[model samples]
Target chain A: MTQANPATLHIISKSPTHQQLYRDIANALLDDDAILFIEGGVYACCGTEATALLAATNNIYALSIDAQSRGLANTTPAAITLISDQQFVELCCQYHKTLSWF
Target chain B: MIFSILIYASSNSSQTEQSALRFTRAVLQQGHSIHRVFFYGESVNACSNLIVTPRDETNITEQWLTLASAAKLDMVVCISAAVRRGILDGAEAKRHNKSSANLSEGFQLSGLGQLADAIIMSDRTITFGN
Candidate 1:
C-alpha cells in the first residue's frame, strides 16, 4: 500500500562462501522493493558487500522467527527490520508479487 | 491468486523438490491457481527418468508428475540447464544424437523465456532451493 508497485524478495539460503546467490539477489531486486530474509538468509545482511548492495533496496526485513532461532534478533544490521510471521504474509499480499531466493 | 514456482535444487540432494511439492499441494488446496512451475539449475534433474529411488523413500519425480497431471499444471524445465545436465526430451535427444531421452512424464523443456513469461503472467514467483 505504500508504493505504486511493491514486490517482495524473499531470501532463504546462506549461499555459502561463493556468494553467487548474493550477486544474483543484488542483480534481481528492483527499486522501491522490500526484501524478506529468513532461515540462513539472515546471514546475508551481515556481510560488508551485502550492506553496500542493500543501499539501493528500499526496505529490508528479516523474519523474527528465524532471527530469534538463529540468535540474530539483536545482531542484524540496523537497516534490517524484523517482522512477524503474520507480517510476512501481509508483505506477500501487499507486494502482490514475491520472488523467493532459496 | 495466481502463483508461479521456481525450483533450483536437485532431487538427489536438496530439499527443494519436496518443499516445492508440499507448497504446490497447499496452493491448490487453498484454491489458488498456479500459472507455471519453472525448473532451473539442478532441479531440472527431476525431469529425468534414470534416477533410482528406494521403495521406502519418497520419489520426488513421481510426486511432481502426479501433481502436474492431476492439476494439469504447466511444468517447464529450463532448456539451457537441461542440456548441460543431459536431460533431453525426445526431440532434443534426437537433435543431440542421443540414443534415447530421459525426461520424465508431465514436464516440458523450454527456454529461460518461459520462466520470464511465468513471472510476467503470474501474481507471485515462489522459489525453492539454493
Candidate 2:
C-alpha cells in the first residue's frame, strides 16, 4: 500500500534522455500522486523515449510558459495539462509534499 | 508554521537560488519560521566563500548570508554532496588534508539525516531546482 500522504513529483530538467530519472519516477509514483514538468522538463510528454512513462503517468501537467516558449503549446498531446504559474503555486499547496527532480 | 527549504542547484546556473531566496523572504514576511534550509546537490556550492561575483551583479551568496543571519536560520550543506564538490569545513579540510577551508561563515557541513530530520520536523519542505 502507498503511504497515506504521497508526495507529488516535479521534474525541471529539459533533457528527454535522462532515462534513469524517468524510470525512477515511474517506479516511485502512486495512484493519487501527480507529476509536473516545468522549465525544460516539458519534453517528457513527447517522442518514443517518453512513451512508457507517459502511458503509466496520470495527472501530468506542464507549465504553460515553458510549453509556449518551446512551441509546445499546440502540439503537446492531450495527456499533459498546461498550468499557469498561479496554478503551480496552488498545486504546491494542494499536494501534501513536493519532490523536485533535476 | 515552520518551513523546511531544499535547494538543489548551484548559484552559477538556473534561477533556483533566486526563487528560494524570494520564498524565504516571503515566509518570514508572513510571520512564519524556517525550521531548516538544506542545500543538496550543486546547491552545496552556494555555501562557499570562494566565489567571486561580478561588480554589477547581485551576489546571491551574500544575499543568502544576510538573510540567514537576519532570520537566524539553520542552514546545512550535505557533507556527501559538499565533499564531492570540494566544499570543506575546518574539520573536513583537516581530515582531507586540504590546504584551507572555504565554508562560508554561516553554513555548516552535515549529513543526509539532517535532511530527513528537517523533512520530519518542519511543516512543509519545498524544493528549488533547475
Candidate 3:
C-alpha cells in the first residue's frame, strides 16, 4: 500500500543522526531504487565496506560537483556514476519523492 | 502525486524546516497534493506558538500555520517529540499538570502512528532531516 514511485534518496550529512538514518533506510531499500550522494555524503562513496555492499545493488550515483569540491573526484569508488546538478534535478523530477538526509 | 513530508530537525537552528517548507510550496505549485506534513524530532517545536522571532526574521511557525490554513492541509506533530521538546497542546498541558500550552493554530499534536499510517496511505513519504 506504500505507493512510492521509484525513489531517489539524496544524503548530504555525515553526522551520527544522518548515519543512523542511512543505516535504517539502506536496510529497507528495495531492488527498485537509486541513491544520490552529495555534500558530506560523498564520504560514503569512499571505497568503504558499506559502499561496496551498496554497490552490489547497482543503484547508487554520486554528485560530481560535490566530489570535486571535496577533492574526492578521482578517489570515489568506481561503482558510483558521477552525475551533474542538472541530472540531479532531472532525477528529482523523475522520482515520485526525495528523502533528504542532512 | 500525494506526498507526506517528515521534518526531523529543529526549526530555529536547522535549515531542514525551511527546505521542507519550500519543497511543499514547490510541489503544490507543480500540481501535486500534499497529503500531510508530519513534524518529528526537534522539528516538533515548529508547532509551538511561543516561537518568537526577531522583527527582521521570518516567523516560521506563523508561516507554517498560514500555509496549512490556506491549503487546509493536515499538520501533525509527533506527541512524543513535542513532549520531549516542551511543546504541548491545551489538553496535553492540562493532563501533564503544566501551566499552559502554546501550540500553534492549525497544528495538532499526534503520534508516530500517524506517520506510519501516512507511509501506508500516501503516494510518497519524503523525509527532511539533519
Candidate 4:
C-alpha cells in the first residue's frame, strides 16, 4: 500500500500586502499541505489576488467569524472553505504540524 | 494529541492574542490536550500584572489567567522578552534592582529552551502572531 504524505496546516494572519510572505508560503508548501487564513489574513479571500493564492493549494480555509468581522464573509470566494473556531482546532489535529505566517 | 502554542503578538496591539486564547479554549473543549503555551516576542507583555485595561475593553491577560487556572496550563513567558519589556517577576525584579515585580500570577518566566522542549514533547507546535 502507498502511504500518504504527512500534511501541514499553514496558519496565516497577515494581509496580502506583505507580498513576499505569500511567495514564501507558496515555496514552502508541499502537495499535501493546506492553508488556513485568520485575522488580517482573511482579507486574502477577496479580490483578484485571491485567485493566485487559491490556486496554490487544493485545501484553503478561512476563519468565518474573522472574515465576517472584516466584511469579507460574503465576498470570499466559494473555493475557500469558511470554518469555525471548533473546526480550526480540528484542522490542527488533522495535520502533522502547523506553521504560522504573520 | 498534545499541542504547544507559541504566541508572538503583543496583547495590546493585535487581535492575534485573543485569537490564540479562543483557539486554546476550543482545544480543551474538543477533549484535546495542550502541553504548554509559550509566550515570546511582544506576547511576553501579557504576563504583566500591572497592565490596566480600560473598562470598555476585554482584559486579555485576566482572560488568560482564568483559562490557565481552570485548565492547569503551563504558561511560560520568555524571560528575555519579559525583562526587556519591563514585565519582571519577583526574582527578576530583585536581581535587576527594580522597585517592584509585576509578573502576573499563574504565568512563569523561562527561556527559549522551554519552547524548544515544547516543540519536542508535543505532537504539534502552533504559532499565533501578528
Candidate 5:
C-alpha cells in the first residue's frame, strides 16, 4: 500500500447543484481515500451517476442511517460500507482530515 | 476529533439548519471540539438577530445564538453570501446606511478563507447542505 496523507470526504448535499458537485468530486479524485455519504448524498447509493465512478475507487463508504432515512436501505449498491453514526465518528477519528462538500 | 461545521442551508423554513444543530450537538456529546460553524448562502441569514418568526415556528437564529453562547463556538457568516443576501451586521449595516443590524449575538462576519483555515486546523469538517 502506498503511504500518503490520510484523507476522508463527507458529503451532505441534498440539492441538484451539490449532487452534481459530488459527481465531479468522484470523477476527479483518483487517490485511495474514503468518502462517507450522508444526508442527501445517500441518493447516490441508489445508482446515481457517481455510483459508477465510486465502483472504481478502493476506499469509499456511505452512512447507513442516512441512507435508511432517505429510504435507500434496499437500494444501496454493493461494495459500500453502510455505517452507523458511531462508526461514522470512528471514520472521523481515523482520517487525518475531512473535506466536506455541499 | 476536532470539527468544523459548514451550514449551507437557509434559516428560512428548512430542516437543514436544525439538522446541522443536532449533528453539532451530537459531536459535542461525543467529546469533540467544534472549531467553527461557517454559514454560507441562504444560511447566512441564520446569523441575523433581526429574524422574528411566529411563536409556533422554530427560531433558527436564536438556536444558533444559544448554541454559540453555550459552547463559545466561533460562528462565522460568509461575507460574500451575507452581502448578496442582505444579511448585514451592525457595522456593515451602518456603513451601508441600513436602518438596523440583525446579526446574532456572538456571531461574526468573515471571509471564506476562514473555511479554508478551519479545514487546515481541524481534523474533520462536516458540511450540512441542502
Candidate 6:
C-alpha cells in the first residue's frame, strides 16, 4: 500500500491582520497538518480568525512566550494550546516539514 | 532525524531571528542533530561582524556564533544575498576591492547549492523568519 503523506507543521509569524497571509495558509493547510503561532501571529488567538482554523484541525498551538510578551496569555482562546520553545522544537520534529509564513 | 534551518527574515528588524536561535537551542538540547543552517535574504545580515549591539541588548549574532561553535554547526550564508547586503568575506571583499571583510567567524558564505543540498540530505527542513 502507498504511504500517506506525513503531516506538516505550519509556522506563522505574521498577524491575522495580514489577510493575504491568512488566506494563503488557510488554502495550503491540510487536514492533518498543525498550525503554530509565533511572534505577531499569536494575535490570532485573541480574535475570531482562529475559529476557522479550529474547525479544520485540533493541533493548533501558539508560542506561550510570544503570547505572554504580547499580553495575549489571558485572552487566548481555549482551542489553541500555548507551547514552549522546547515544545516548538518537538513539533518541528514531529512534522514531515515546517513551512514558515510571514 | 537530521534537520535543516532556513532563515529569511531581517535579523536587525525582527525578533524572528532570536526566536529561531531559541528554537535551535531547544532542538540541540533535545538531542536532535542539525544538518545545516542556511541564511538567506535579509537574514544574511547576521553574518556581518560589523553589527554592534548595545550593551543592554542581546547580541544575536554573537549568540549564534557561540551556539554554532559549541554545536559545530554548519552555518552557511547565501552568497548572492550576502553580496548585495554588503556582508562580504575576505575573498569576496578582496575580489570586489571593498574596504574590509565583515563576515563573522563560524559562518561561511556559500551559494544556494548548499540550501539545495540541505533540503535533499536532511529529513526535514524547518524555516524560521518569513
lDDT of 6 by residue, A27-68 (tens): 888889999999999999987876677678888999999999
Q: Write the per-residue lDDT of candidate 4 for residues A64-101, one digit (tens) a residue.
A: 99999999989988889999999998888888778899
- Candidate 1 docking: what grade? acceptable
Model 1 alpha-carbon drift over 4 Å, by segment = A1-9, A15-91, A99-102
Q: What does candidate 2's lDDT look like per residue over A1-102, in tens digits? A: 123455575554555688888777777777677788876688775676766666665778887877787888898888889987656655665677777777
Candidate 5 clash pair list: B49-B102
Candidate 4 fnat reads 1.00
Put down candidate 3 lDDT per residue, A1-102, tens digits, no spaces. 233466555554453335566676667566666777765677776745355338436767777876787788998777788887556544666676666656
TM-scores across all candidates?
0.67, 0.67, 0.67, 0.95, 0.76, 0.94
Error of 4 at A100 (Å): 0.8
Error of 2 at B67 (Å): 3.9
Looking at model 3, residue B116 earns an lDDT score of 92
lDDT of each: 0.76, 0.79, 0.73, 0.89, 0.75, 0.88
Best to worst by lDDT, what's the order? 4, 6, 2, 1, 5, 3
TM-score of 3: 0.67
- Alpha carbon deviation, residue A48, candidate 1 (Å): 17
Residue-level lDDT of model 1, residues B31-111, one tens digit each, is 778899999998888788998888898788888888889999999999989989999999999999999999997899999
Model 5, B3-109: lDDT tens digits are 89888885456767876787787777788899999988888876766677999998877787787888888999898899778888878888899988777778889
Clashing pairs in 3: A102-B130
lDDT of 4 by residue, B17-60 (tens): 88999999998998889899999998988788888888998999
- Please give the RMSD of candidate 5 to the true structure: 3.9
DockQ of 4: 0.90
